[model samples]
Target chain A: MYLFSAHNITKNYAAHTALKNVSIDVSAQTIFGLLGPNGAGKTSLIRIINQITAPDEGELYFNGEKLKPHHISLIGYLPEERGLYKKMKVGEQALYLAQLKGVPKAEALKKLKYWFEKFEILDWWNKKVEELSKGMQQKIQFIVTILHEPKLLIFDEPFSGFDPINVNLLKEEILNLRNNGATIIFSTHNMESVEELCDNIALINKAEKILDGKVHEIKNTYKANIFEIGYNKQEINFNEIVPQSYEILSDIHQNGISKIQIKIPADEMPNQLIKYLIPHMEMHSFNEILPSMNDIFIQKVNEQKQKSF
Target chain B: MIFLFKKLTNRSKNPFKSITMKKIRLIIQREYLSRVKKRSFIIMTILGPVLMASIWIVPFFLATMSDEKKVVSVVDETGVFVDKFESTAKILFVYETDLEKSRADLTKEKYSAVLYICKPTNSIPDHAMLYYSDKSPGIITQSYISNAMQTILKNNLLINAHNISKEDFDLINRTNIKLNTEDIRTGKKSYTEIKTALGIFSGILIYFFIFMYGAQVMRGVIEEKTSRIVEVIISSVKPFQLMMGKIVGIALVGLTQFALWILLTFFIITSLQIAKPDVFKSPKTEQAFDAGQKIPSADQIQLQKLQNQEIKEMLTGIFEIDYGLMILQFLFYFLAGYLLYASLFASIGAAVDSEADTQQFMLPITIPLLFAIIMSNFVINNPDGPVAFWLSIIPLTSPIIMMVRIPFGVPVEQVYLSMGLLILGFIATTWVAGRIYRTGILMYGKKVSYRELWKWLRY
Candidate 1:
């Protein structure tokens, strides 16, 4: 079942359109990647979901109900430019934020202690936020963002300031949260993480949603009939063995090995190419090459840019 | 997550109909606690009363401390003014024959000044000159010398030319008049001076507090914006809630500080009076006591009775002031004025990315407050005049101008009208400020102009 969804949301600033008829649905217990380039209205959509700014024209539903102020406590948001009160104590600020999210004071303190201990930042509890390093502060922010254990958490560039180890830690925690039945909307420029973590994604560009689906499904749709073959060098030229109907995209030979990429016709089977190449070359490996999310993002955005002109 | 889900289901059954005051209370608690716990607040709380008490006590000490006597040498060219100069506690007069000798003595610092009386060319001397080596004689000494000389010359003229006896001249010059002012309606003495002082005191205090606390509210906003914490906060609570929470929080801080200052000032002044009773005595009372010591025994009782009567009149005058009404009005205006100005300050702070950028917006807010202060003197002089009436009615200037007219017994209806208008003004400004603040806090890096602010208000 869908945990949260935005329908035909449109938002506008004074002179520019921030969002235009954008729609997205996040299913329960899944991480939904919100992918876009800079200034592509991704932040605007996230803000609408958080109710930080209401959409000029649209509706939002949380847990199959119309979104309201009470829904605020159910959703947690970590903005791209998130910060804590610099002069406030670490534990104090965390507890305050949790309380603002509608957690009882005692419960907030208990949760804060658990998170602070889990993150190994218990010693820094009394220290002022400004005294902590940037990564340390980000850790505190991350803890506060999920302290209330919100059912729907929205993270905007969640891993921006973290080291690789902390990034992995955060990734594990995000996945762990999803396993516990929380839906997450992850917005980022990092496509590799999206490929690894996201169950589904919606690609927005120029204030419009151009693509969205399950991760594997979208990849399958964008995949061409291209395959890479790796083999040992043989007497016959590897290029000559390929059918004339098939297009050879690249051929490279080095260190007694040959690697070639070829695009087969849609009418032809991939096994037919293997059948033709078996007798001519030593077959070590053969695999179809699918487009990475990074490649698809750039290609789609570029295509949209061209269409706009 | 399970807990949140359950809570969500429960809340979704009955969604919030309005912005939650609970969240705003949390914000207010944080804002108020963070400031009240600061070292600066503590220091100021303690030091404010000390400074205020010193303002009351320092002048009295200074007045009684500077009792150094001044000696003036008289060099009368015509010998008509010999033995005529009288010596008092502050100034002493001595006759000298040689003008050049007295001038030299003045240069040698033997005398404070040398008064040279020129011989009369006609009925009276045309001009008289006084010389000193350095630091000319004070106004008191100068006026004293001139008055003594005038009396001596006039008496001489009266006795020689008009054939009037000294007794008749003395009796004629002793006609002193005293005017008493009373409130015709209540048959009470009208203490215009005391009331004027109270009105101006309260007016200036309100002005000072509004600016002091209003700037604090602005700085708090800028801190939240520049620190980038506002986004995180507004996600949980509305921008209006956050803004009002901050304004109200800082106002409580201001009220707390003011209350502490009043209590502490009273305590300090009273303890000081108990410790040093002589210092608390007015200089006039002390002088009367000194004169009593030197005068006859019977006159001492009379002087004491006169001093007691003066003190009693002053006490009665103080008791006649409507302290309850004054305090109530002060509190209302202080809070109302602060809320009005603080919301504007908060909007300005949100519109700018840094404190330096607030300069362009501060002028419009400060102009009315400054104009009210400048017109306060006129208001005090003519409380019921058209200017005072209109200024006291306008909400922007009324907090201060109306306060200036309050002690002069402003009509009840006009005060109510002014108060009602001030509340309406506060609500209106808060609405505009909330609109601008919500949009401005989210915008960054761009220089905001007035046109941009107008657009934000519309948004």
Candidate 2:
């Protein structure tokens, strides 16, 4: 069952429609990635869910209950642009913000300490936030955002400032959070992270969701029945045995091996291509390849772009 | 863990209370802590009291420091007023020959300038002419010479008329009558009562500065709101709580710093009491110190008293100050009066995002404060009168006006009425300000004119 759902959400900024009937059903205990380029109404939709803003026409349900003001306590939001009182001490600011999220003082501290230690920012706790480096500050911010052990967590560009080591640490922690019953919405421009982390994705472009499905399924749906045939120093002709619908994308000799990548139309499959190609050429290797999520994303966006014309 | 604890404790109490009060406390705390914690607060707080106490000592020290012998050279060309300029203090006299040389020489070496006295010339517009260059002779020297010269001239005329000896004239020298205030009410209502009223005036001055500046604090919050920091804070807490927390925090800071100031002042006055007891002492207690030291004699006191009637009347109820009441009313007015202004300021702050934007609505709030200050002066001048009655009843101006009248003794009814009005003003202003604050907090980059602000009030 879905733990969080935003149905038919729409938001208008005067003459501009920021979000139009955007919907998502985020399942519990999974990382549901929100992938979109800048200004695709993701922030507007997130704001509606967080209750920072009200949608012009939509409703959100959380944990099978209609979302209310008090439901804000159930969701932890780490905004893209960080806001921390510069003059306030790190610890003091963290506890204050956590308490504002409705966490009791003693309990908030216990959780905050656990996260601070896990993040190794406990020593920097006493110093004023302004004194900390940007990365360190982001870590502190992350700790406070999740200190309440919120049921659902929203992080926009959560790994923006982390180095390689910290990035791995954050990834481990994010997975840990999901394992601990927190559904997550992670939004970013980093497509590699999406491939590595996301269980499902809703890709929005031009304030509309263009693709919404399991990541692997979407990638598979975009894959052409293509095979890379390799032979040593072979001259190949495609017109006779290969169907006219088949297309040669690349035919190159690399490191003394003749290789050719061909695409078959939807009516044809890679097995049929392999069957037909064996009789026509001295085939060294034949393989079918799946498209990357990056390719699918770009392809789908381009499809939308083309459809607009 | 500890970090979270500190933050919670440091954060204002649960932010879900009334917003204006919250904002006031926050801003007051911010101003108080930021200002009080600074080295400047320490220095100024200590300096204010020290300066007040030294007022009684510094003048005497300055008077003593300036006691060098000041010479006066005179040439009585008309011979009408001769042998007039003589003094045994800092001013001394020497007669010099050649008027031109004396004038030049005196100007060169600072001989209190030469006085070239001439009899009333027919062509001269002024009846008497005394020539000096670029300086008034020090008062002591000028008074001595002018007195001696006038006495000599008068005696000459008297001798010509009646042929009396100088001794007879000296023995019977008499002046005109003098008028001085000897209040019919005595004992508990004497000089101390007058001094207490003066103290009350000081208390009122403090209330004004706080009231004025406290409103500034409110305006500052509203300015910040207009700028959009309120949104940044509101993201974490409820609007009302945010408002109340800020107000309480700021008030605490103000109280802390103010308490520190009072303590510092007490130390300053106490030190002065230990160091320079003569001035701080009552005039009666200091009579012994005046022995053979040129204290005002009975005739002189009477004349001085006649000349200073205006100051005496202004400070008439000075000795009747109620210290506890002054403090209590101060706190009441401070909170109520500041809340009233701050509520409006917070509304303005929420409505507009910047100081420039706030100007369009600032006058509507500020004019009343300015009027209060102006009206207070009037109330002090005419205590217990009709104008004072109306001025003291209006809450906006009442805090200052009533305090000004406190020295003059306002009726108990007026005080309670004024207090009630001030509180009512706080509530009404808060309601209005809250409306503006709620709408304006989220509105950004928009110019909020007074008309817009007024509309916000309606909405």
Candidate 3:
């Protein structure tokens, strides 16, 4: 069963509509990547799910039941622009935030101690937040978000300020949480992390969802029928031998080896192009080219931008 | 089990109704503990009493301390005043016939000043020019010399015009009376001076708490907003609850500080009283007069005695008040006044992005408080005047003005009405502030204005 879903949510501010009929389903024990460009209503949808804001029209469900206030305790949110009290001690602030999420004070302290030790920041327990570096503060914020052992966690731009090493550590922790039966929804501009971590993604463009599927399926759905061929020959012109069903996109010859990219019609496949080229050229290799999520995101957003203009 | 099931079902149906209390408690705990732990709060709490006790203790200590004797050489050009300047507690007059000799002797540092008493002309010339090398003598020295001359002149005129003896003249001049007012309703008589002091004390106390604690609430909100911790906090608790937590938390801080001040002040005052019982006693005569010099007449001694009696009466009048009830009402008015102003301050804090942005909106909130404080002086003077009555009824000004009238014995119906209206005012402002706070906390980087605040209220 899906752990959470926002069905047809719409939100309007005084001067703008932040979200319009955007719906997303987050499955259990899986990472849901909310992909969008800036100002594409990702935060709006997250806020709606968190109930920080009420949708002008929508319904929310958790585990196939209607969402309610008690569900708030079950979900932890790390907002894009999160902070801690500058003058407050690190452990005290973490414990306070944990208790705010409904964890009892003793449990909060115990959990915070464990997390502090795990992060190797136990020495920072009595230090003020202002005394910590930005990266260190982000670690504290991360610990606060997960200290309650919430059923679902939402992280927005969670990797913005981290070094690569810490980013990898954070990604590992996030995946570990998912493996331990907690659902996660994270939003970011890092398509590489999305490819590495997300099981499912929904791409939003201009307050609307343009693509939604399992990550591999979405990548496959946007792939063109193109193949790259390498031949033993020094040079080759495809104009004479290529059929109308296939056309050469690029041809390059270097050091007695020839490489050519050919696009096939919708009715044709990469195998058919290979079949067409086999008679004229000795094939060293043939491989299909699939678009990355970054290309897909740009193409979809640009296409939607064109459609609107 | 049945009750638990019913509660679960009800909460599921209307969760918001019951979801706020636990969160609000957490927020209040954070605010109160964080502020109480701050070094500034601890320092202010300890310093407040020392400062307040100094107001009453410093003057009394100075009055009772050992006085340095000052000798003034009187170069009396008017022979009628030679050897007539009587010595008092600090000042000693020595007759000097030669003005040049006195002027030359002045540098010896044995004398404080040289008093040149010019002969009385057609009118009482601004008498007695005083000269010193470096420092100027105090006003008391000149006033004392002039007063002695006036007394002698008045006695001479009375003796010549009425053919009366000096004893009769002395008896007539020593008249001392005090005004006592009786309440028509209770038939109880009391001094007007005590009532005025009590009225002003209560009014200023209310005024003080509202300003001090109200600004604290505003500063706390601004800190949360600027530090960007408010969003994390408000996500767990409602904005209204957050605002309320801060308001009540800071109010408790103010109350704690006030209680500490009162307790410490009383302790310090009593300790000093026990340590030096004569600190507040009657003034003593300690000047060294020449053995052959004339002493001050009995009339001058009687005058000093009358002044001492006045001070003793003022002290006794302070003890005559019904302190328990006054303190209870003071707490009520202080809390109500604080609530009313703190809500307005909180809204101002939420509407602005920084402390610098608060200046534009501060005027409207502060005007009524300033007006009430300024009008409280008038209220103390005329507690039954129309202005005082109307101001004590208006919710904004009533918190202060009513306290001023209460110690002078306000009508019971008016107190209840004022209290009711003040509570209503607090609730109304809190609701309005909650609206502004909810909208403004989430809004960042925008320059907010009064018009924007109004729109937020509508939202």
Please name the candidate that would achieve the greatest lDDT relative to the true structure. Answer: 1
Worst ten in a row by lDDT for model 3 chain B: B283-292
How far out, in Å, is residue B41 in model 2? 4.3
Candidates 2 and 3, the one with greater lDDT? 3
Off by over 4 Å in 1: A232-236, A252-258, A280-284, B1-4, B11-19, B66-178, B285-312
Per-model CA lDDT versus the true structure: 0.89, 0.69, 0.83
lDDT of 3: 0.83
What lDDT tens digits, residue by residue, belong to model 3 across residues A1-309?
Answer: 788988998888877888888888999899999999998999888877777767899899986778776677778888887888999999888988888887878989988889999999999999999999999999999999888887789999999999999999999999999998789998999999999999999999778898998999988888887788889974456777778667678888888878888888877766667666788878998888888889998999999989998
C-alpha lDDT of residue B378 in model 1? 90
Interface Cα root-mean-square deviation for all models: 1.8, 6.6, 2.7
- Per-residue lDDT tens digits for candidate 3, residues B283-356, read 34322223225565677678767776877777766776778988888899899889988988998888888898
Candidate 2 chain B: worst 10 consecutive residues by lDDT? B284-293
DockQ per model, Cα: 0.65, 0.19, 0.55
- The true-versus-predicted C-alpha distance at residue B265 of model 1, in Å, is 1.2
Cα lDDT for residue A292, candidate 1: 98
lDDT of 2 at B317: 44
Indicate the residue-level lDDT of A287 in model 1.
Answer: 93
Best by TM-score: 3
Which of 1 and 2 is ahead in DockQ? 1
Q: Assess every candidate by TM-score.
A: 0.90, 0.76, 0.92
